[model samples]
Target: MTDLISENLQNKTGLVIDGAMATELEKRGVDTNNDLWSATALIENPEAITAVHKSYFQAGADIAITNTYQANISEFMKMGMTKKEGQDLIIKAVKLANKARVDYFRLLHKEDRDVRAAHPLIAGSVGPYGAYLADGSEYRGDYQLSEKEYFDFHRSRMQLLDKAGVDLFAFETQPNFDETKALAHMLKLDFPDQHAWMSFSIKDPETLCDGTPLQQAIKYFNIFDQISAIGVNCTTLENIEPAIKNIRAVTKKPIVVYPNNGDIYNPETKTWKANRQAETFTDLTPKWLDAGAQLIGGAVEQHPKTYNK
Candidate 1:
């Protein structure tokens, strides 16, 4: 397995991941009201995807997650594209991110580039199956699938991402315990040389959205060397610290946390409303690092300005 994440962590306090992709695309005047979300930009406004990735790198992010969070083959087929066309879009997502990385590095002064802690990484975003459902089932984790079904749903995208040359996978916003296990198993059996980080959608500080205890979930992946890091994401700022403590108590592996900008999501309406008591990343990043978060970032409603802090 590659020691990409571990090697980076050994030199820095924490690696900063890029902020939200879909929401950032929305700010650039892209239409994301459809089921495809940010992936729509892959076909219609690919240059915007590259610009977003470069913006994050400029904002000091150490990783740029590709815009494939909702770009699965099944969804593409539903949009009237053939299977080959859909798979091409998935590969295109990684190419766009890599272009941004190369373009960003080329613009940096040689002295500035040489002073970097580690090279910025491209994380192929493997969003949960609920993301394809596009109804916010990711936050509830109520879906069920047999072992073969889960494998069938995720395998093609993983293979495409791997073939496209992602530094690693970012299995972010996962909520179902069984689905996470299936993904971990798939990584071990099918993509033996690839490494990934698994970040969950939590119900509270103590449990996953599917009701598995946070400690139990963290422990389950402790033996999987391929899971480079384990933590939570797409959750509120308030939930991060306690969840990190729970995860750190169970594993010595790196912990990745990217909580949403404190806003309440109405899955039914697919809109966000302000949270009066929401905490800022400036106020919480130090606490999270102290509590054991090794990689930190913002989720939906966050932007380059948020990460620049």
Candidate 2:
């Protein structure tokens, strides 16, 4: 299997992943107040999803993550969609991002089109099972599931994403260590050709949301060759540097970090509160790179323009 991420990083300082998809879609006037969140656009306003992807690419992102983070089969089915309809929406998410990549390139100058860096990769966003609960269990990581249960919940969506041709999987914002271990095992056993970057939701610099030691969780996957990169996401800006340093201490793989804007999320109300003391991505990107992050981006409330240097 080709290490697509490594190929893209050969001569680059770092790969810039696109900013938040749910919040970006909300800015485009798509109502994301529902459980579907950004995936609601897949049915109500798909073009807005495509437009969001294009905007990120134009903002100079090296990777555009698909908006399937909350678009699992069970969630879509609960909305009165059939099983097949739910699967199609996941595939559509990938297509929209792929179209944005294609359309963005056509808008570039002919001379610039041939450059490797100008071509962006599409990462299929696989959010944690907690995202499907739509009650903010992702941040808590208190849910428990047997290994088979975890694999069964995730396998179909992964198959759909892989069949749709994503460059890689973004097993991101994961909180449970056992759940992630199940996913890693499933990827190596079932989808051997595909690779993914795993980013955890953490409680602090040293602990995962589920109470696992950050270094222990990261070190456990050192033997899984299918995991291409490892780090943290949807955490505080203050946590990025220490998390990256911790990750660097355990593995030589690329470090991917995309923390939330200074705001803090309240899952009960599905709202965010401003944190005046939160550091800006502009003020922190270089520090993250210096701390050994090879791939960087933003989480909630972070707009594409934030990456426009």
Candidate 3:
């Protein structure tokens, strides 16, 4: 009984680079004079999605995430996709990732192709529930079914990931802890054989949203099984290393760091430019490896160069 995902997770730490936003950008073709939303462009041409994954694989990434994060059914509803239609889109997205995995394996380990037979694992990404029934300010408001809404959302998508044969299932950019925890449990229940990873978004102050200390989050998350790793994502590059250090101080579990490129603001373009210097990001890679970081990679706006550098 060989567990491919857990085997990869047990090995020495490796990079888990980001690709969705870049895939969207490349597919959308950003114009300097005009800002664009990544969704519309990706829906039109998914090859942009495939190319991004291949680049990460070539850059030494050990895992690649499919472009199915925000492609969830609920999120798709916002973009006018029915539940069936969204599921179909995700199935197609995973297939594209599988194709990239085949190509990446060929490029990176051409010699080993005959031996390994498979490329790096493809992690199916489940994103935020995206249905904030209550206003942001109403954090305590009675948003009915808040827990069920999120859990059901993840469970629905997890089933699809299972059918797609994703090597791992990852829940990322979670804003709330209880909801994230629920999703984790659901994944474990559904796929006791595969691996699961959770990544929380950092508050502006670099803590969980409930003012819960970072150490508390680490302790709270320690109860689950099959959770190969945990870390911070979708935040500034500068904050990730320190945040991960704090996380490591509490748990012996593997830590993942996939911070967004950088904070961005657009005066005239009304865009958020979350790109960072690949060289500097690369410099921190060694330190992160030394800091006991078991996994590291980029989030939004991260290019293949970041990992390759």
Model 2: per-residue Cα lDDT over 75-153, one tens digit each: 8889899999999999999999999999888788865554436347899999999988889989989999999999999
Q: For every model shown, what is its TM-score relative to the native structure? A: 0.95, 0.94, 0.79
Between candidates 1 and 3, the lDDT winner? 1
**By how many angstroms RMSD does model 2 differ from the true structure?**
2.2
Error of 2 at 70 (Å): 0.6
What global local distance difference test value does model 2 have? 0.87
lDDT of 1: 0.87
Residue-by-residue lDDT tens digits, candidate 3, 20-57:
45434543474323222343334676777777777666
The runs of at least 3 residues in candidate 1 whose Cα sits more than 4 Å from the true structure, single-residue gaps closed, are: 299-309
Q: Candidate 1 residues 1-309, lDDT tens each?
A: 566998777767788888888778888989887888889998899999999998888777788898998889999999899999999999999999999889888898977665554667899999999988999889999999987899999999999999999999999899999999999999999999999999999999999999999899999999999999999998888899999998999899999998888888776665678887987787788899889888888743333233222
What's the true lDDT of residue 121 in model 3?
75
User: What local lDDT score does residue 265 receive in model 2, on the 0 to 100 scale?
Assistant: 81
- Indicate the residue-level lDDT of 187 in model 3: 62
